[model samples]
Target: MDTATHFAMGFGLAGLAYLDPVVASTPALAGAVMIGTVIGSQAPDLDGLVRLRGTAAYVRNHRGVSHSVPALFLWTGAIFVLIQAIMPQAHWFHLLSWIFLAVCLHVFVDLFNSYGTKGLYPFRDKWVALNAIFIFDPFIFAAHLVGFLLWASGVDPGRSFLLIYIIIAGYYYWRVQVQKRMTELVRQRIGKTGTYTIIPTLSWTNWTFVAKTEHHWYVGELISGEVIILDTFTIKPENERIAAAKKSFKVQSFLAFTHHVHVETKERPFGYEVKWIDLRYRSRFQGKSHYMFVAVVYLDFDLTIRDSFVGWIHRGEDQLAKKLDSNRQLS
Candidate 1:
């Protein structure tokens, strides 16, 4: 989920806090909880600061460790302690409970999106992406906006937010059903799939799908009850050169962050270029050419990595050429 949605969710959680009699009765404690909720909601995303290091670092660690299980407890405790230190008059127990809920909510909702979290970190580093929701859902945002408007209009914030959450919960349940049906439809069409993923778009009926068989990757779109095959790629057997390229820092990090990856190796004039693409993000814009989130590694004839770029980049071939050319000029 986007930051705005997370912040709005925090705000709604604060409203739900009214259910607690202690929060309802104590004004100072209620104010502290509200403030804590808002901060806790976005604290997990503080890892966005990793972008300063580079796209590789950002991709590798953005939701990798910061959104993990241990991080969840750490963030909750840290936020509670910080808030408690500042507002000593506020009841400690209520404040801690609200802040902890806010932080947990932030991590929990992220699991539903296409770009998921490694929330189970120490236990398993595997990324858990439900692919049931878009990173930014307009409907979720609108609900929060409406709730804010109602609160601003002098409506009881707690009750209004509670009602909004009930509706949102129903919406999530419906989305899950829709996603299940979409997957079923796709599986029926593409029999004997090894890995199948249906990523939700902004529209309820429209979805993007990626399925892997033993031989090929099936990438397509399900729009208006139709499965439109966008493009397909043949799965290549891994070789020593490709294996060597995989050991590169960029490729290793990219692998850690994504699944259903399709690797393509091409021989160039100077070296070999290995492209690692995440099929889950495959898309075609305005009926133009298809694109997928990709990383590229340029290797010498001996299979030593020359240069690389990772993360959600476009035009893998063109970008690789430009990066190699730039490196050549610098050398």
Candidate 2:
């Protein structure tokens, strides 16, 4: 989920905390819990500061360690200690409880989205994306927004948020069913020769589908139960050129973070420009060009990496040339 949604969820949780008799009895303690909840909600994303070093560092570690199981306890304890240090008179039990819930909820809700967290880090160093929800879900955001408004208008926030959460839980359950149906449809249409990755989009009926067999790669869209093949490419995992290209640091870093990698090599005047794209994030530009999360590596005549960048880029020769030129100069 996005930052705004996480923050709103934290606030909603704080509203629901009012149902606790301990919190309702003390106004000062309730205020402390509210502040702690809001901060704990966004603290996990503090790893985003790694982008200051570079996008590659950010990509490799943003949610990698911070959203792990150990980090959940770490964030909760750290926030609890800080709040206690600032307000010694406040009730520690109520404040810490909400803070812990806020931090746990932040990591838990993130598991529902396509860009998921490495929540089981030390135990399992793998990205676990459910692909049931979009990164930015308007429905979830609006539901929380309405609850916040109602709380501000003198409505009993505890009951209102509790009811809202029940509905949100049902929404998630329905999305899971939709995702399962879509996956079954893709499996039936494509046969069982290859592995399929079905990623849900903003619309409930639309999905981005990718399949990789022993010899080919299939990229398409599933709309309203119909499978539409947008493009197909031959897979050559044993090719010398691709093998050499994967040795680049940029490709390795990208591979660490993404699941489905689509590599394309183009010969340029300087060298072979190898582009590694994460197929899970397919989006259109101007209703014509297709773009995905990409990382580009320029290898010289001897296959030495000359320059590289890891982030979004236009998927056109001219645009790529311009980006490469800019990257080279910056390097």
Candidate 3:
């Protein structure tokens, strides 16, 4: 998620949680609580890039160390010790207490959906995930929006929005096993027979698999049993990578993603750029190129914009080689 979205969610949580009785009487308390909560929401993301080792990769897929319960306690104690002790004027326990609640609420809210949480800190082996929903679902977002609006209007309803999300997230969580089984069946068939390659399309609602062979791309809705075949995309993983070769795709697989992706280049002496036409469309599901694809790889000597991966070619501007100015007349 982008920083803006995260901040907005944080603000909403803080503003709305004020409506709850525990936080209503004290604005200062709510402020500290909200601060703790929002930070907790993002705390798990710290270990996102850290791969302890290749050994824990499976459970660590989307479910990693940050999502682990150990992580929660680890962070809690750290936060408590740091903030509670550093600020001596305020009662360490008073502030620490609210912050702890805020952090816990943040994690629970994230627990629902397929991106499960490691709720049981030291004992639980599996994660608590509501697989029915996608990690970034618009529907879930809509619900949050409503909650935020209601909270803004000085209405907390004494109901914990975080708790509500858990219940709803749980409903979807239960359905994930069915989809998991379906994915396992496909994984087995393709894994052994050497017939197809599966691509995981992490959608907001559910996990969709795109199995590709040499000739066709088999799109299957894991839970819906809806399958479609397309000739553009390769069924095999090898070709699939080639088929989905845009630079944007590469930028997306980050420990975390930020929406404000901007590219800038400085003016240089003897600015030079070389570009060409190799036609390519957005969706190459079919295994054939219709002379409409082009890869314009340009070499720029300027350090200001050395190796910018221009994911798209609109008209005349090469994504990287083009001057950074938006109003400099499209040439």
Per-residue lDDT of candidate 1, residues 1-331 (tens digit): 9988998898888888988989989888888888889999999999999899988888888887888888877888888878768876447778888888898888888999888998888898688988888989999999999988998898888898889989998988998888889888888888875888899988878999988888989998999778877778898889987898888887887888887888888887777878888887764455546355777787888888887777654553455456557346323
Compared with the true structure, what per-residue lDDT tens digits does model 2 show for residues 1-331?
Answer: 8989999998999999999888878887788788889999999999999999887888888887999999988999998888778875456777888998999899888888878899888899998888888888888999999999999999988899999999999999998898888887887887768778788787878898888877777788899999887877776564566677778666778899986777888887776778877776666666665655788887776887778878776664456567679345533
Q: Rank the candidates by TM-score, best first.
A: 1, 2, 3
Report the candidate with higher lDDT, 1 versus 3. 1
Give candidate 3's whole-model lDDT: 0.45
How accurate locally, in lDDT, is each candidate?
0.83, 0.83, 0.45
lDDT of 3 by residue, 79-163 (tens): 6666545443254455555555545655665565434566664577555643344455554566667777666686663365665
The lowest-lDDT stretch of 10 consecutive residues in candidate 1 is: 322-331
* Winner by TM-score between candidate 3 and candidate 1: 1
Residue pairs with backbone atoms closer than 3 Å in model 2 (clashes): none
Give per-candidate clash totals.
0, 0, 21
- Which candidate has the top score in lDDT? 1
lDDT score at residue 167, model 3, on the 0-100 scale = 54
